[model samples]
Target: FSAGNNENSIEAHIGINGEANLDFLNIPLTIPEMTLPYTTLTTPQVKDFSLWEKTGLKDFLKTTKQSFDLSVKAQYKKNKDEHIIPIPFYAKDFQVLSTPNDIFIPAMGNITYDFSFKSVLITLNTNVGLYNQSDIVAYFLTSSSSVTDALQYKLEGTSSLTRKRGLKLATALSLSNKFMEGNHDSTFSLTKKNMEASVTTSAEVQIPILRMKFKQELNGNTKSKPTVSSSIELMYDLNSTATGTINHKLNLESLTSYFYIESSTKGDIKGSVLSLEYSGTIDSEASTYLNSKSTRSSVKLQGASKVD
Candidate 1:
């Protein structure tokens, strides 16, 4: 779920005035998925054909049922640097209201560092001069169960070095025993023996190079006739310099295999009614220095019928 690196440098400057400096650097990367059980309320009811013999509502009620699914994924990274300072100190224990019963001494050190990152979320706390001459560092990274738990497995690695020609590399891998289902919502209903169904699928992926996020979705219904629909979307980082915040959204729509359209729109709209729909989009961005991002979204409608 997470990984990190820590390095310490003891610099000795030999000059008119001899000086010693200690510096520490830390970098961590994490991908965590957090998921919560989807909840819904269900009600049982009886239906009679005589009640809606001539109403379309009766036909609609007879054919459809409803269901929902939700999921989320988050990615995170953090870097920290600190200057270390050693202190000479000693501590003695004594009775609160009487003469000292025992005496002890301990050495201590202090450190200061700054941390920051994205996608996976994290919190950090660093303590200087803890338990004699030691520095304490701690962090937590969290992700949506739908994202992290869904991955069958993952592999990660890191490499770093200073002015020296030597390089240090570390790698990690993890696998999940359970399958994480993608985000999906569906409705099913029964009218007599005939059944009707509708479903929607949604998903998101993070692109670190461009510092952006991408998402896509599809929604449609199943009927005796060919009824299909789908959508796509993209998001990007508008401010790559300051907060690294992102702003982007593109969309696409398709009907069967015959027509396709990509656009940004709100509210309700209608597209061709075909047996299938195919839609997709690509979202990417790059900053001037050390910042790049990319993402993609796609949807397809398929059936036994063949279309060239």
Candidate 2:
């Protein structure tokens, strides 16, 4: 992570870059054999007996019982074979079969499935940039995987500029500190005045189930935490103060997607020792498209007409 600025414009960047090579050689991986015992009720079988002696319709027909056992097995061979995988459980000739039912036999007893492949190389990168000029706010992200090389993703953001009297400012600031009892403080502040401003960021991500290729038998989880915030404070004179901020976040996953946005502003003017102040906040959050169980939003407004 680094930041620098010159006479042209102010710029700052935060990035995480990594590369990894994974090779698995004859790893002892096994799927324990599972036995499923099931019972089947066959069609009614009629009892042949002396017609007039005694059997009525209820006694004539009787249901037949049958029991069956199903065995599930996998084929894994160890002979100094190495495989590199981009994702977990990724291999060649890997087949997933459903459990057999009475009507359909998915596979015979002890079906053998192969999970073997080549080695995998993975590369990942993520970046977030804060800029004060519109022309210098666009950024590009480059990444690679076992399947593809040199994949580029473009990310763009808005730039802010402020002008007062005859002074113009374009700047980026970052501060991080750790103190007492594992407590940590981290903050990224970008200011663009007298111009339209936006924050641009990009990240390398794998969509939960789709990219991870998680099986129903195995559990997997993915979470993303991206935040964008902007605030402006204007000082017309020492007797007056004003500030405002807007923050938004959009999170998406295989099972759910969430969006949140909040904006608040406050202003105060001092009359000798007394002061008048007003503030309002609009906060909202709700799920979109996928899940609705995690949904809620709130709004708050407060103001003080007179302060002594």
Candidate 3:
């Protein structure tokens, strides 16, 4: 019989000049083996035994399996408009082994702009990045084997700007693009805002195997203890293929309202209450994908009363 185990870890960092970093790692191990009882018999007698004769049970033996894991990541950035230039860098690496004999490595890197356009209400930012993989090796108790190495190169760029229209009205726009070995992806978003309400929308499209996506969000609240808030999101994707096209869509909506109770020195009591809720999601898949959609929902209701 075989058994499996899983482990996970997360890390975070923050530095001076508005630099932040985050990382996550995971590992899984599995081992399988079999055992059999010894029989009382001579070499000729063993051959005569029907139990051993029916199948190749004598060839079975217990075995042990082992695996290894390693992950490394780091990010640093500093931005100051006073200085003409800004500096930023990010890097990540992941490795895995099914058995002590096999090894794999995946890596990514990024470097971006510094802080010189701070004075402008509307500012632009950009970055260049790359992702690649190294060759893998497999080892056996007696010998070793290696696989042909492969690498992927990527270049990315982005820009965003915000402008104030009037006393309480403002708008912002963002655009980004990523170029891979033989594929390209691009995204754009726009937002309009005012004192009482705001509206925002975004869209993304990828080439070489066409795909598209869109999303929107809205929010508002009042000072009352039992304040109410709600939000909704929608996403869609279209896949082009030789056989046919596959389309997928996801929608999510949620609302929450809650209040608190307080007591005074004279033993007086007060109470506030409201209803809360949430909902949304996409279908599950056999394995994790770089781009996938999922939805979540939640709700709550509670109240308390006091007497003096």
**What TM-scores do the predictions have?**
0.19, 0.19, 0.20
- C-alpha positional error of residue 283 in candidate 2 after TM-score superposition, expressed in Å: 13
* Candidate 2 TM-score, true structure as reference: 0.19
lDDT string for model 1 (1-308, tens) is: 22333343211211122222211111222334434458454434433323333333234333323222222222222223334454434454642344334433323232222222212211122211111122222222222222233322222221122222222222222222243213444444444433344444433333343333334444333344334444444343323321222223333333343333333332211122254432223334321211124334344322232222
* TM-score of candidate 1 to 2 decimals: 0.19
RMSDs, each prediction? 29.0, 32.5, 27.7
Error of 2 at 140 (Å): 24
Whole-model lDDT for model 1 versus the true structure?
Answer: 0.30
Local accuracy of candidate 2 as per-residue lDDT tens digits, 1-308? 44454533333333333332212211224344344457453444344433323323123222112122222223222223223333333335665544433332222111122122122222333333333232233222222233332232222222334333422333332211111011112222333322222332221213222111111111112223333344433322322243333343343334325555555554444333335554444444444332455655555555445443
Query: Of 1 and 3, which scores higher on TM-score?
Result: 3
lDDT scores of the candidates, listed in order:
0.30, 0.31, 0.28
Best by TM-score: 3
Q: Cα RMSD for candidate 2?
A: 32.5
